[model samples]
Target chain A: MEASGEVRRFAHQQWPYEPNYKRVNGWQMHYVDEGVGNPVVLLHGNPAWGFLYRKFVKPLSAAGRRVIVPDMVGFGLSEKPVREQAHTLDGHIANLTGLLRQLDLRNATMVCHDWGGPTGLGFALSNSDRVRALVIMSTWAWPLPPAEFHKRIFPWRMMHAPLVGPYLLGHHNALAGRGMYLSVVDRKKFRAEAQSVYEGILPDPGSRLLTWTWPRWIPLDESARGLARFEWLERELRKSKFPTLLVWGREDEVFDHATFATRFKELLPHAEGPELVTGRHFLQEDSGEEIAGKINRFLDRIDGKQS
Target chain B: MTEIHVIENYTPEGKRRAFVLAEDRVGHYPEFREFFVRQFSLGANRLERPGYVRASSGMIYALVFIGRSGEPFPDGIEIYALPDALEPLNDSDVDADLWALLRWMIAGVGGEWRVEQLDATGRLYQLSVAANA
Candidate 1:
């Protein structure tokens, strides 16, 4: 499925916000192709698109890294196809698969967050050869923790909930407010300017649902498909043994730091580094410059291996 | 009618109190009694010091802190929205949205407000809300 009218408007107006890139599949796929070297694929999560990596684009590129940030369908400058199926994890993986095949991205250093965790993991799982290293932040790839409401109302149940879910997500849940951005941030980093930029991208109600619907669609508990997908990726990570770096926000309000560590450690224990960052869920937004610096150093360590 | 119910008192330092508050029958932030006492001059006494922080009162109420980094600012306290005490604010019409729920969860509980499966894998969500500024 393609992006909906709401996300379409978002793609048209909100995008090209930075520089480089153009329309693909009637959706605005923003990308920065500069410097030139192997490639680095950065996938963002819900309530965000390719724009999330606006800062990393230039630096990584200047350092001779072909950084590719695609606003996955239903987010940022990418097309927001509202159909629940359109935004599923597997579907996204497929979309990314096609994009990678088309772009011929290889030896990539993936920087993933929130929903991007699974999406990026999915890519690595399938295209194991393409990945050189990974940087995961404030996100999870584990199956849903055992919780009832978390079981029922995850990204799936809540998205398709009777009257209540849609209303809460599509309208009442103003994407511009704290519901979308504030929730992920640590209290110490909350600021008006950052909030303004977030609110600025999403001016109308339609464009906002793209933010609200993301969490609702995650099949947290009984999502066999998502679980299977995640499991398959985990198996690959274990089998492939690709280097991975995890940076978690200790004070995160969404996914707890300890919980994130316990799960990721079990999955990628062999990976070089995984630390609980004293940041928030929106690590890129809250600590963008810091995160970029970390990524720069992390990738250099791996890229330097060949040199 | 304004309602104030004690939800917890188990700290060992100053008094630690949690209250279930109602505004026009609507549930808002769950405030700590001691902070209210200090900030509003309520003069409420703690059962003892560190009464609420160190001990578990065996109840589920939202925890609140006034300042960032879990600092308990005067009048900034915890409000325990007892399970039974949680009543639908609206019967005929509802203004509650995801945003409202997010705000209430943040203000009411210092952590995320997640409704998990009543009986399942224990899946949970850390209901993220706005800062208390």
Candidate 2:
């Protein structure tokens, strides 16, 4: 999915980071590789792309750290597979794994948000030696059932429905349209221009399949498609003894930090925060500078500890 | 068989509290509750404190507890349903979506279970595992 002229112009104005790409699984996976030093890989989640981290790349890199933010296949400027099954958890994990191996990003700090939590942590768990530290935002790494109230929410249930999900997500781009705005606490931050950049990447119904499949892929039970892999990742993450930092937006209506922060603390007991309280689900949008500052300090502190 | 006993309490201020008592006929309440909390996006800290675990959507808050069957534990899992949380369900379509989500949660447990919604208004929403299956 190539960025349209409008998206390119928007990127030029708002996000000026150098655009880089690598062919992963026969698809052009777009990423941002900036600065120079110990690598910091940023991962994004559903309804978003690498552009989600546009604000952080420059600051983190300027602070003497390389920042690598990749748009998963089916997102941003990456090639979108026509088939829904092609966007499986394994496929995403593989694409990222290949990209990291190709770049030889060793002892890197992984900063992840939303679905990035799972995919990034999934990578960390498997490649623990390569992962020096972790910065987790609003996301989960376990396979659990949806709460009753979660079902009541229109988007969660509607996106999973057989007929309705395809129509709303694929046909209308409902998530990119109204869903993104609803997820944020500060609505003004997600202005018309931002929406245009996101919508431009997913221009048509055919390009929206990845967005449609993500919500439906939430593993509600052991029987759900990716439950086994999620279970494995969860077990590995729980046992992983890496230096970790957790930053959260208290106001996130979806993936509320109050709900999941404690679990993350329990999993990585030595992990540093449930830091940054002002933002929403997309904390990058609300508190990107604060998050980046914290990341820099976290890196320095962990490096000091090792020395 | 895993039995999930749900107890609903209403305060004088019209606030609602929900509690869950998981009794495993096969003696796996702890395991079941652990898995249950993880799946429902319930915070593990609440297991040690009197805090509420908000769902992923930040709409539902559940105060969860785990114990052996017939151990004289709290009668049920207490859920605090804020007005804003339940407000969206005012629409009939969203209400149906809620039921579908509940049904999906029930199926995830994968056992013969029964959910008895004991509300004073006689709005009994019983979720029989077999029926949901």
Query: What does the i-RMS of model 2 come to?
Result: 15.1
The segments of candidate 1 whose C-alpha lies over 4 angstroms from its true place after superposition are A1-28, A146-161, A173-176, A184-190, A223-225, B1-133
DockQ of each: 0.03, 0.02
Candidate 1 has an fnat equal to 0.02
lDDT of 2 by residue, A12-43 (tens): 57788767878777777878889999999999
**TM-score of model 1 relative to the true fold?**
0.61
The interface RMSD for candidate 1 is: 13.2
* Candidate 1 lDDT, A1-307, residue by residue in tens: 2334232333333234344434544444545455588788888876666656666767777777887877676655555554443456777777777777677788888877877788888888788778788887767775654123344333434332322233444443344344445455554344433555565555544555555455544545453446776666667666667778778776675566667756677877866556655566676666666677777787788767868
